[model samples]
Target: MNPEDWIAHDPDPVTAAELAALDPGERAARFARPLTFGTAGLRGPVRGGPDSMNLAVVVRATWAVSRVLTERGLGGSTVVVGRDARHGSAQFAVAAAEVFAAQGFSVISWEHPVPTPVVAFAVRRTGAAAGVQITASHNPRTDNGYKVYFDGGLQIVSPTDREIEAAITTAPPADEIRRRPVHPDDDTLVDAYVARAATVRRGRHGHPRVALTAMHGVGGELALRALQAAGFDDVHTVASQFAPDPDFPTVAFPNPEEPGAADALLRLADEIGADIAIALDPDADRCAVGIPAAGGWRMLSGDETGWLLGDYILSTLDGADAATSVVASSVVSSQLLATIAADYGARHVVTLTGFKWLARADAELTGCSLVYAYEEAIGHCVDPAAVRDKDGISAAVLACDLVAHVAAQGISITDALDRLALRHGVHTTAALSRRVADPGEAAAMMDRLRSNPPAELAGFPVTATADGDAVFLTGGDQQTTVRVVVRPSGTEPKVKCYTEVGQAVGADLDDARRRAAAIELQLLASAQTW
Candidate 1:
């Protein structure tokens, strides 16, 4: 794995003209650092040489993907492709479709742009061998990615990704790819996805006063269709930032979690007196929920929404056989779910921190109905039967439905959180991420933190810590459970540091809240010095 040999298997220019035409800077960049396919699939800025996610790289990757299916006795299988409204996304989607078709696979393309999750669900619904989504998933505007889903509609994990990377890096020349024409009706997957999402809708409360924003991506239309199908005839759309634009003109970064990404929707909600505001990321697999609280449309953290949604689902099911197995990430908030599962006679399991892991793990862990699975990063899987992967459209419908169910009890979302806090004790989580300019630098930072462990962080004495190859999990499991896991972002140069603080108060919410906050401050301060 010499640095120079990373792209050794990549196709070289057969004709001097092709190499001559490549941008000098791009050629140099690719030569210096070829794209490394990781567990998260291929991701990088849409620039550089053949190593980047440009047309040449995409074609090669598609060939690699096709080769994978073929090797697994799944070649020429149906392939469903979806795309977000990101820059170059549409082109990438078409390129993928063309390549899949050229490889003799029937490609079920989307006529219009659709959410990333819809594509994953469609792969399972249509019995496709695999699916591909063209999106970066909240990354900066300059970047784009290729996310692959296997036959079961879950992302490819560990060894599978490694195998795919080998195929991609050693893929044949782009010109050698078989070219085929796409039929007029090759994009029927959109209709199927829209229809399937309709089944998850449980209707809204009262007039269904809610504001919706697509963050200038392609999810708004499909979201509206699902909302209307669910009988929410009055889902108000935010006037601005509602259209599907590749550039994402309205927001700096198309992610809804950032400040002001939900500003337009909140402003509209305030003016219309809406009960809730729903914001979906550019690709639509991830979504954020905003409730009318604290005088404005206050956005609920991923953990808060998971608790609210889990509570609603658990209480609504009437039968004793209505089993609930609450699933969450290793880094997510387990306070509410752990308590609620006990009360409902359900088992709570912690999996590695990704929707792919949660989805696949839930399927593996037997003995109970996998009620709900979510991670702190706004990914949620509501009906595992319908879609084994996270679906923003389905999550959006379920969130509104939960609001309606709670409205019947004359309670607001904030009040529900407070009651949960009273029952399960308070667990507040905070995250701090620094953008290391180089991947090596990010690795170095994690190395330094591991080699020189802090004896005392802030005020609390460091009880114990676990140093992983690429991450570290530190802090005392009692009083405050501080988890500091650092890894090079699968898709970006940034290295994320996750911290969680939990306190068990028998039933005293105030005491738990104070202790959790104090622990959080201590963890943050300690992390800052690192």
Candidate 2:
């Protein structure tokens, strides 16, 4: 179809006007290719293009989702729609609900901005056929997205996503789908989500002064409420990031894992003499933690937090039925969690590189129960039974509880990390992201690494190689060693290289860190080149 055809059917006048103003080359670039669903759903810049995130793209995606659900005998079933506090989020969410309703589906629309996991929780809780979240997660303000969840509250896997893409390719025009007003609901679901998140607390600890940052996302108010409900009363929030701000004025990037993203929270923690600090991403599905250490206050790496929380959760459930309690992490995450789980007589599973795979560990494993799942990019699924996605709120509650319990015993989270390091032998990890100009460049980078992988990284020979959409060019598999995973970011134009350098705490933790850091730095510098 031509750009003129698209402009005629486009629902948003702003988009149509923009399309009309584009030159021949610009118009061809915008409408010649359509944005397809990737691992993270339909994400792109907020603009008027078939390849960008806009009203037409969202409407088509929503229609495709409805068709996919209805094919499975969910014609009249209810579908939940939620949005975050980003540009065009509410509008995109409304457009999605309208499309679903036009397709003879019931729409349970969230009128206000909410966390991404809230929509995931609502899908399972309501027994809805599917759910849609209008968000870009930690992406910049210029971008937005549409993420779909199937009946099991899990992100759609291979065939389903492919099927939805097929349906989207031939879906009806935006003007053909009838627009409908979204009916608002009371706070029943929100209250239920808060209650369920609070139940993750074992009532083991209380009264630890916590300084938290919401990263200028919509999770602040709800996160604060969940903390109070979980028996933590002394929670102080960073005022600059305490409210929902679409522009995210306080930080260069809204993602907590980004450098200096948690600076405000750490500063507030130091001022308030807080025991710990937690940072929730823009949509509050990924969590990053910080603690006051001997040198100063520093944010913990995703692996460090993963190990701490995994150790805590596993030990708490130690006496349960043997081989029943299970934990999961992404393939790119630290191997220490699996090692710990095995030593505790519990089962551990490693999935692909996202929460979409990590969240379904329990359903895939026959007999084991999935009590925990985590990724090295600040995503953790603490209570998968309640929310089948990486939930920043519940993870923070557990982190705060652990800090309180340890603080009561005259120790800090840093001390707990030291004990974990001594036991797990210092599994350190780092990520090297090389941003590209476009998705094609990202794919080219991945292909380059696969075709011509580094024979040796940091003086360690490439021991093994696994090639696919992502490539694992590793150096050691000595039960605990080094790895480099090269892949394209699902939702952004970036080729990412994740590196992990693990070593035993031979005589001193400091020595182990020194060795690991040297190896990690070399790997990172070389990884960045590719």
Q: What does candidate 2's lDDT look like per residue over 319-412, in tens digits?
A: 5543798899988888889988987888888888888888888776687778999999988899988899899999999998888777777888
Error of 2 at 264 (Å): 1.3
Off by over 4 Å in 2: 319-322, 477-480
Candidate of highest TM-score: 2
What lDDT does candidate 1 reach at residue 209?
83
* TM-score (all chains, Cα) for each model: 0.90, 0.97
TM-score of 2: 0.97
Prediction-by-prediction clash tally: 0, 0
- List ranges where model 1 is wrong by over 4 Å: 1-26, 184-188, 201-205, 318-326, 330-335, 367-369, 467-483, 504-515
**Residue 524 lDDT, candidate 2, scale 0-100:** 90
- The 10-residue segment with the lowest total lDDT in model 2: 473-482
415 in model 1: Cα distance from truth in Å? Answer: 0.4
RMSD to the true structure for each prediction, in A, is 3.5, 1.5
**How does each model score on lDDT?**
0.73, 0.86
Instruction: State the lDDT of candidate 1 residue by residue for 1-530, as single tens digits.
Output: 23233234333333224444557665565657767665356787775355466666777788888888899999878987877777778777888899999888998876577788887878788788998988887887888889888857878776777777788767765656665767535545676677777776454456558799988777888889887777777788876788877677788878887777888888888988888899988778877999988776788988888887777766666556445455444443445576676677666667666666777655655666576777777778887766777778888988888777778779988888888877766768776767878878987887787778776654555643443445555556555555555555667677776666667776567777887888778777777666
